[model samples]
Target: MQKLRQETQGFGQAVPPAQSAELIHTNTISRGTKFGFLGPAVISLAVIGLAPLAFAIWTSLYNYNLTKLASMRFIGLANYANVFSDSAFWQAMGRTFTLLIIALPVQIAVGMGIALLLHRPGIGFLKTITRLSLVIPMATTYAVVGLLGQVMFNLKYGVVNQLLGFTGVSPINWLGVPEFAFATIIFWDIWQWTPFCALVFLAGLTTVPPEVEEAARLETKNWWTILRNVQLPFLIPGLTAVLILRTADTLKQFDMVFTMTRGGPGSSTELISLLIQRVGFRAFDQGLASAQAMVLLVITIVLSRLYIRFFYREV
Candidate 1:
């Protein structure tokens, strides 16, 4: 027994122990290594990231007029007060969140389904074609999508009505009415962004082992069963990433909606972005705009941080 113990000790000493402190330390990187050199780079990025935000906070407290920079006065919380009091600002914010409620789930589900289809083997050409189609919409300029959407929804001669005309249904105003305009923006969002969500899920799907999928096939189950049991667990990380990204992007959306509807009809579809732009540039109310922008920035940051922390902790 003593001899056997000695041999085991020798073997253990030759190989690093599971709980060894030295084994826990990864890599043998030197102090002079390139990664070590990134200390300065990290500091630079920290400064860059925080500087503008600090400036915005400072400016939010002051009355900053680009035309009269010298005339700027320190008016703490007044701008913030005005923004809170503005009924239009609240209305626009309500509409923005409403859009998110309508669009996020559909985007995620449809995108995941598409990604699943693309993951199947022996369909290389189909995957390529589908990816190309999805990429085109995402790559299209925001302004161009807005313009095209307007053209397609034109009340006078819109393609939407032409299609409905074939079904003997009355012509529907796609953008002229408040509800229709709101729905139009939501549809545009789904069209342009579902591809991005799908791309993320597709990226995740590629990392899944083929053997696992083959095993799932051997179970003699339907497609939905395989997807629910096999695919979804693997896609948790990717879905978390997509949700966080889409949430942030949807909240800050400006160019597409403004160009398409410009907060039209009665402020039914007016988003917080349009409201901030109006206060900042159009009305020359920089202080109020900055305050509103700060409010928006805070909301997004809080929500994103919470999402990352809670759902995407590993992300």
Candidate 2:
């Protein structure tokens, strides 16, 4: 073995052939091990995620109405085209996006502030308590949350209007008014999502190497400078993740707005989802409902792809 190694390296160099052979054998086995090792995960993902997506696409092509079974017809791209002409569908798409725009920035800002406060070394106990407290809202069921939102925004006896009444302010129809109704939904979404974003920021903070933060503090006492230059840079990837996740979630805002207003007081706060439900079930226009859904699906897919490409491509 020594002679074989010497011959392969140089006249004076020596190594065992057995060690070289073992290394080569290990490399060969690893190289030949197919990623078929991921078979289960791939299969599970397809069954749970991809299969449903394919099924939705197929259903979108057909007039799959829940009520009028005889009226259901295979309509090809007719539903897809009808989406463009449907004013209600477009309005809903707008509402969903408007909520996203209002919620994402505010939630991200609040979450980062909390995470920054929590990341401080002196506030360990406070951090633990605050984090646990925030988790409660998240743990609460959506239905319950919606119910609470409705009660809170109630024009007559709701606590919010009651609080305003204390200051001699008129008890506005909080849920009935379009402006404040929209605002109410935005607030509810932010309250629920901010903590989640903070959790992401906290994860990013933990990964910042200790020595780097220490060196920054040593150089200067300017907290803002150090945070922007050091911590914020390190947190960009995490920030992107939080933004994308929250944006996607906000697009699906339904129960809170639905339970509170039923898209009433003049359809001012009516969203596409609620519109589709009304058409499909209430109005009994299944084809129109299907078309609206297809449009929604298309918009969601387009935006999701854009976010992935713009922010999460490297990840």
Candidate 3:
């Protein structure tokens, strides 16, 4: 027993000093190698993201106008104050919120319904085709979608008007009138993004354990009950992602609204993004635009945090 105890103690003794030093040296090299691999990505982020943000913040503190570059001077928070006081800015923000309120619920509901349909057992070929079709709107460029909206919603020559004529209804001025134009934009957004939400929800559904679903079905005949009690928990992550992405996209909606309406029919459809564009480019008030943009960034970050806090769940 004494011999065995000595052997065990010897085996458990600290590593040789030379070997320990070698191990430490090897660990240092490994850490250095890891940082070396990460160096390019860190540098790229600094160059591509932080630099522009810093520049924008700096520009926001000055009275920098693209047209009057030589007259540019530091104005501190004047631009930010001006933005908050601008009635047009508030109107644009209100319109943006209106769009968000109207569109998000409809998109979520329709998308959830579509996801439920797609989740069911179906013909393999049909399922594959349906899934592929959902990608079409997402794959289409935003600018192209805007242009297409213009062609399709024209006052007289539009396909929509022609179809309405066949149904004995008057050809409505879809894009010419303020209310119709806003509604048309809403419809356009819903059409383009519902599939994206559907696909995301479908992905979430796919992760649900089959045994759990089967057990739920055995307990409840009401599909709604099973969905609420069993399936929805799995969908929280996807729902959170959809909310965050869609909210951000809607707030920054410029390309489609710009190409389609140009914020026109007399500023009725002027969203916050369009307002920023007009201030920065048309009015040449770079300082004001930068301030507006920074305010918008803050709003986006706040809303994203709220969504994550309330809805985010590990799946």
**lDDT top scorer:** 3
lDDT of 2 by residue, 1-315 (tens): 454454455644344567776664322322214345667788899999888767667766777777777777788977778778777677878888888887899988899998888998886787788889989887887767878989988989899989999999999887877888888878888888888888888888888899999999999999899888888877778977776666666666667677877776677778778888888779776666766766676777787778768766544
Q: For each candidate, what TM-score against the reference?
A: 0.82, 0.81, 0.90
Q: Which residue pairs clash within candidate 3? A: none
lDDT of 3 by residue, 1-315 (tens): 344334333656434455554454333333445678888899899999999999999999999999899999999999999989999999999999899999998999999999999899968788889889999998899988999999999987899999999999998998899999999999999999999999999999998999999999888899899889889999999999999999999999999999999998999899999999999999999999999999999999999999999886354
2 against 3, candidate with superior lDDT: 3
Clash list (residue pairs), candidate 1:
none
Ranking by TM-score: 3, 1, 2
The list of candidate 3 runs beyond 4 A from truth reads 1-31, 313-315
Q: lDDT per prediction?
A: 0.82, 0.77, 0.90
Error of 3 at 202 (Å): 0.2
TM-score of model 3 relative to the true fold?
Answer: 0.90
Q: Estimate candidate 2's alpha-carbon lDDT, on a 0 to 1 scale.
A: 0.77
Each candidate: RMSD to true structure? 7.9, 6.7, 6.5
